[model samples]
Target chain A: MAKVLLKGNEAVVRAAIEAGCKYFFGYPITPQNEIPEYFSKELPKIGGAFVQGESEVASINMLYGAAAAGARAMTSSSSPGIALMQEGIGYISKAELPAVIVNMMRGGPGLGGIQPSQSDYHMCVKGGANGDYHNIVLAPGNVQELVDMVQEAFDIADQYGMLVIVLADGLIGQMMEPVELRKPKARPIEPKTWALTGPNGGKPHRIYNLKLQAPDLEQDNIDLFKKYEVIEKNETRYEDYMMDDAEFAFASYGTASRVVRTAVDKLRAEGYKIGLIRPQTLWPFPYEAFKRPNIKKYLDVELSMGQMIDDVAIACGDKNMIEFFGHTGGVLITVDEVCDFAKKIMGGAK
Target chain B: MSRIDRIFCAGFGGQGVMSMGQLLAYAAMLEELEVTWCPSYGPEMRGGEANCSVTISDERIGSPLINNDATVGVFMNGAAYNKFKNKVQPGGKIFMNSDLIEDSNPRTDVTYYKIPVNSIATRLGKIQLANMVMLGALNDQAHLVNQDMLLEAFKKVFGAAKEKYIPINKEALAEGAKAAAEMFK
Candidate 1:
């Protein structure tokens, strides 16, 4: 397939289509409205379905209904709108249903602003929904990564029958870049024996989020824990850049990692031992990558005011030597600033 | 020539700021270069101020957001000019629409070309063609992208219906480029 220029929002939807997503239910929000708009026009051409639900709450529930019925379903929203979908997300996770949700985060504690932000890190990775389960969060640093991660999000969701979220910021969502849209190999069809579809030739199955007895719920939790253990072992992914002799390491994800990469590259060229550890999966956070024996100091860079910093601190296991740099509420940091900060941190490193 | 070009364009919402950035970004893509286009999306973009940042590089781009150090700036109005005037990198170039912007205090460190892009487009009888004129002026100054690539972008954007206006757009672009050549000489 030839490459085409696509915005991050449009690229995700196109990837979803190639991944065999047949149903989409979403509400419109700034920076990500392109997703729903593209789907509404293109999904029908492929004999798929697209619905603009009454609200974010309604849209996510619509996704739940579709996914429970044994269809590849998805929904997308920005921060506040994603917050509205948390209960539904919890229900989908509890029900053990497969669905893809995209959160193109914006600046927010409320309706903060319609700009790119990474502040929703804690809300997303820490389980915004009230539950014992966590989403398989895939964060991408660029538009190409966003496209690939969207396709992988669907496959991972079906492979584990779990919820997978692509956590991107408004910057990546709205940015346009050239992407090669290939026809992905069809995902192996998983047997949905527990689907809510009416019995035709087999015994009927009932699937819901409710488990009444304490013992039974505990057993379910135990089962989920077992599945999570497998995911933790098999799914943790991170990229190590110039870590061979890194005395100082910077940990970041998504767009922030992009900035840090340039800074690391520039600093490395200038005889600094600074490297970068970029986690592609925010959940099952790659703790192993941070275990560099020679690393003297760790800096966690993010677009938010250090929400992911806590995870970096935990992953590094030595919070004493950890530092954080970020800007919140839609403010962005530059590569030169990051390089300067890295130089300053190296000056103070032990 | 710089290895990477980071260009910013700003104007009122309807002044084709986003389209100007998109045209250049698309042309860069056609040349198989790494590119990114990020628009300022918020309430201000609804019918008021709007801007877009574009980066074309041989290497993968870092951040799409440009807080400072834009290699080139295309301003269509006074507000846009005032907002982005200081952000241009020293020795970088700025192409200002003199029809809409009155002030042209050129910075000693940066080069400024005051092209009445809107006036040229209006003379072509399509005020909306101002973005193409600006693009032409940009190409003439920076040589950031090839002329043929941009014409191909026009074909891709306008499709089969371009026959009626392709010549007009080509004239607009050429006129703008010619204006740029004459000014520099």
Candidate 2:
């Protein structure tokens, strides 16, 4: 396929379509409005549903309904909008429905701003609404990876009968880059035997999450965590770069990782043994990457006020070897800043 | 050795700053060079000094940010010029609208070309073509892409606009390129 220029938001829309996603539910939000806008135009042509609900809350529940009926459904929003959808997301997880939710995150504790931000790390990887379930979180750095991850998100969602979240900041949502149309190799999905398609020999097939007894719900939680354990073992993806003999290691994801790569290159070019451990899957967190042999120090890079540092701290488990560098309220951490910080940290200075 | 041209384009909201930077990025993509175009997509873009940063590199781009490392600055208005004039790296180049701004205190370290884009576009019959004229002027001075290749990129980038506007756009590009050659010499 010929490489064509595409904004990241639009590319995710196209990729989801190519992956056989036939339904989209979203509200218009900055930096991510292109996803719904492009899908609204493209999906109807392909005989799919494009519905803009009254708000983000309604939009997410629309996804829940669509996914419950055995349709591949998706919804995208920025930080605050995603926060509104968290209750529905928690419901979807409890119902064991398969859907793809996209968070092209912007700054926020509340309505922060319409710029790129990764401040939703804890909300995404931890609990936002309230639950013990985990969403398969895929953090893609570039437009091409975002394209690929959108396709993979659908597959993973269907495969697990669970929601998969495509995590990108506003930079990936808004930037333009050349991408060739490609779909990941399709995984054989188990038939949705649990879809709400009416009676099976006059017996109602339930897609309900109304476990009344505490023990039953506790058992359900236990079963879900067991599945998550299998996922943690199987789906944990990370990119280990130049870590052969790395003395200084940097851990970042999505946008921050891209900057860290340049900083790593600059440091390596200057005779420093620096490497990067980029967690492509934020939920699975890839704690194994932190268990390296020769890394003396770790730099936790983020677009928030040190949210990912906690994860890095837990991952580096043994030593208090991690230092944090981050920017918040929609400010981006640049390559030069990362370079300077790595040097400062490596110099044994805070 | 390959040179990376990190270009910054800034202007008012309706001045086609994003469009100009995107076209160059598309041109580089067409040439199979690695490129990225990132716009300042916020409230400020709603008429308050809109801008976009572009990077066309021979190697994979790690950070698509020109932040403070822009090698070229193209400003279409005085506000845009003032905001980004100091962002150009030392020994870098700048192209500004001569009709709107006169950088009386221009930097001594880099070359500055005052391109009369609005006047050229006015002469070319459409004032909106100033962005294209500026694009051509930058291409003329930077030699970033060949004229024919840039024309191809224009047709590809604005697929539907080609039939109705390419000829005039071609003229605007040529006039700006010619103007640049005359001025720089």
Top candidate when judged by DockQ against the true structure: 2
- Scoring only chain A, what TM-score does candidate 2 earn? 0.97
What C-alpha lDDT values do all the predictions have? 0.87, 0.88
Report the C-alpha lDDT of model 1 over A1-350, residue by residue, as the tens digit: 66788899999999999888989999889879999999999999999999999999999999999998989989999999999999999999998889999999999889898878898888889999886998999999988889998998888898888899899999899889999876545566578877888988888877868988999999999999899999999899998888887899999899888888878878877889888899999997898888878998898899888888888778778798798888888888889989888878888443
Model 2 pairs whose backbones collide: none
Q: What are the candidates' individual DockQ scores? A: 0.72, 0.82
lDDT of candidate 1 at residue B52, scale 0 to 100: 92
After superposing candidate 1, which stretches have Cα over 4 Å from the reference? Answer: A183-189, A348-350, B44-47
Per-residue lDDT of candidate 2, residues A163-220 (tens digit): 8999999999999999987868778789998788888688777777678899999999
Lowest summed lDDT window (length 10), candidate 2 chain B: B40-49
Rate residue A209 of model 2 by lDDT: 65
**Candidate 1 chain A: minimum summed lDDT over ten consecutive residues — where?**
A181-190
DockQ of 1: 0.72
The docking quality of candidate 2, as DockQ, is 0.82
